[model samples]
Target chain A: MATAADITHIACVVYPGYDALDLAGALEPLTMLSSNVPFQFYVVGPSLEPVTTKVNASVVKTVSPSFGQSIAPTHTYDNPPEKIDFLIIPGGMMFLDPIERQQPTIDFVKKTYPKVKYVLSVCTGSVILAQAGILDGKRATSNKACWAWVMENCPNVNWVAKARWVVDGNVWTTSGVAAGMDGMFAWITQIYGEAAATVAANVIEYDRHTDASWDPFSDAWRTTDPDHGKSVQPKFTE
Target chain B: MATAADITHIACVVYPGYDALDLAGALEPLTMLSSNVPFQFYVVGPSLEPVTTKVNASVVKTVSPSFGQSIAPTHTYDNPPEKIDFLIIPGGMMFLDPIERQQPTIDFVKKTYPKVKYVLSVCTGSVILAQAGILDGKRATSNKACWAWVMENCPNVNWVAKARWVVDGNVWTTSGVAAGMDGMFAWITQIYGEAAATVAANVIEYDRHTDASWDPFSDAWRTTDPDHGKSVQPKFTE
Candidate 1:
């Protein structure tokens, strides 16, 4: 049994305009694993300040006085822990705006990926990892709703069209927001055992999709082959 | 189509030691309804301070800095908006510690429920509503893991065993944390028709369980009759 000494440190990267479900979907299941396996988590960002999501100001303003206040990072990218066992990145529509706008997040992922045991991305979060060259020569998937944009931006990645999640070596990528929960459940199964994963799912009453190849969205969205699409010129600035 | 003039204000009652997914699971689906229905949200609590969850502190402390920060509430119970269209209450293990411990939360729901169009509870959140007398004579459900405790505390309410969610008039209650997403999806369907709910579910990539009667967990957990069990004396103090 893993003890406190064997605790793994997992980092969840957050940013302004990130999807709240993308973060919560993954964290909820992962946190439930704590009772079985000793592990810790870190919400890392550019700074320790609060980051807002894209949930529209007027709707969330009453609850979150400023922007759509989502989460406040515990550690700045500049001062992360010396060792991180796992890293999770969540997605949002903001990534589709301008690739150059994600430089800070890109830089942080690039600097930290080598030190982590596993790197995971949810929805458009794969875009940041792709921009950092972390998903190069790796199998990955992103939010199917924005599949064309992801394929256009990161041509080097083996982007799977019909997949709930894709795992290549130490990298894990998932489709859309809620899919992250399924990916996290699968990841927990990989780390611990199926029993541990089942317990976690039961705790949250989540009917997890265990099969990575199971994705009905690709058919729903009619995602085409990456090669057949007219690729938008990569606009990411190093 | 609902315009800005027809916007509904939904207040999510939050507290310290609340379950993070209980809030997020419901909010994620409901927030997606905003673009279609023109609705707003408010995270109301005792104060505007950061509230933590049951997620192990060691895991989140590095990311949140203090008290394993989860979310910061927008409005206080003492000063909420003039009118609220809906109310949501999320549940956690803390509620099981002592029913009286949740006096403040119960009071808030009781005071605000009459003005809202609907009241929703996720996981053990049903306990709070039940304690508040909002669920009196109303059919409801709660987190299956804590089924016995919830049944014991809120015997006055008609508790259903096999249910993904229950809707008695305008009050909605769901079993467990992730079940809240299903409940919210159903609630959206009630407000804006199935088409709008489908769009919201598609956006989040959520395969919503539409049937309120579809609950497999009750069979798995071996839940018995709510009336069959010897009721524990209500511990909640007025």
Candidate 2:
């Protein structure tokens, strides 16, 4: 039973080189909820400067705070909502490598996860979550193309490779770019109840794909060489 | 040379039921072209009530010297550019049937086509063009899904069934929605030159699919389709 009050604050963190759809997919679903629930959400990026996507047609802007850096009640819908209930991180091609290595950003994710109700990632964003050490012994997933790489670098995490969306408790991740939309709906279903989420999906005409739930890493991995043992793990570039 | 002066004006005609992408695709390419050429374009619909898309997320304000009303080109960008270089119609799901039967609108298109230098349609926009009898006996194309319907209704027209774009003299039509972008570049190529169009395509990173031009109604039709005898005509119930 997710009420409008339950979603007091929502923030999408965007860094330089963020993918447009990675953020857009999540934003679209959130707006559907907003259109009905009347919750306040804004594009929060590194700065006020407008950022263009890699494709270059779409433009995204940032939100600013009028109050002190930290505001009230864990989560308020004011100019600067202090309490964050949901924090979404969208991955773009440019942010792929750097964000995984960004220590300060990792610390921020680590610090914020305990406070937020749900921590979400789209596309390569799961890599960032992995580097932050949040997925240790936790079931997680990432962009399918990068799953092999994730397994080698972040061994502590159990990766679900075959899912369009992998949800384990409060941590959720999605595959590729467009799959983020699926991930958002999955999030909405949990927060707003299935009926509300289904109606929202119908309004957008997006048919939820079947491969949308979480599974363990063993059955999820797909390797080309059957002769080669499953012992071969993913490798990191740096 | 398609010099800046050659394109004194551009017209993006909007109907009561128009798709946003068609207008956008045409506008973005034209805007990109404007960097090299100076031209102005405006949105003109049947009325001025702030037309909305089928999905209703975006709203486009309409302008006029209404279609049948007398035009004083000096007053607004609503009129086709000074030379009437380009007249574009974007397609939307609303354009599927009933709106296509509007007498005054069709009459305006019928009367106006020969007067313009280049007449173009994006997606189901060819429905309007066909209904106006502009496609009669002309070699053209439209969104792939609507090809049979256009052929059945606009009998005299020779439809190209499988092309992303088709150019027949000054008349051009595109398959599907995004193809309008390619069609615009093609139109610019005809007006300016291949070189400038190539540059514009490069700016957008448009990877034009270099497939064979598909003309299902031509002599090549006999070689490809043995069952060309079957005719599945589209019925537009207005």
Give Cα-based local distance difference scores for all models.
Answer: 0.75, 0.55
Supply candidate 1's per-residue lDDT for B85.
Answer: 78
Give per-residue lDDT, candidate 1, residue A34: 64
| TM-score winner | 1
Residues A134-197 of candidate 2: C-alpha lDDT, one tens digit per residue: 8888887665444555566678888765666788878888775556767888788767778766
List of clashing residue pairs for candidate 2? A74-A83, A75-A83, B2-B192, B9-B81, B137-B156, B137-B157
Candidate 1 local lDDT, residue A177: 92
lDDT tens digits, residue span B52-101, model 2:
33332333112111101011112222343344556787665432445533
On a 0 to 100 scale, what is the lDDT of residue A44 in model 2?
A: 49
Can you write out model 1's per-residue Cα lDDT over B35-61, one digit (the tens) per residue?
Answer: 444555677888877666743343343
lDDT score at residue A213, model 2, on the 0-100 scale:
52
Model 1 docking tier (incorrect/acceptable/medium/high): acceptable
What value does the lDDT take at residue B140 in candidate 2?
74
What candidate 1 gets wrong by more than 4 Å, as runs, is A1-7, A55-69, A225-238, B1-7, B55-69, B225-238
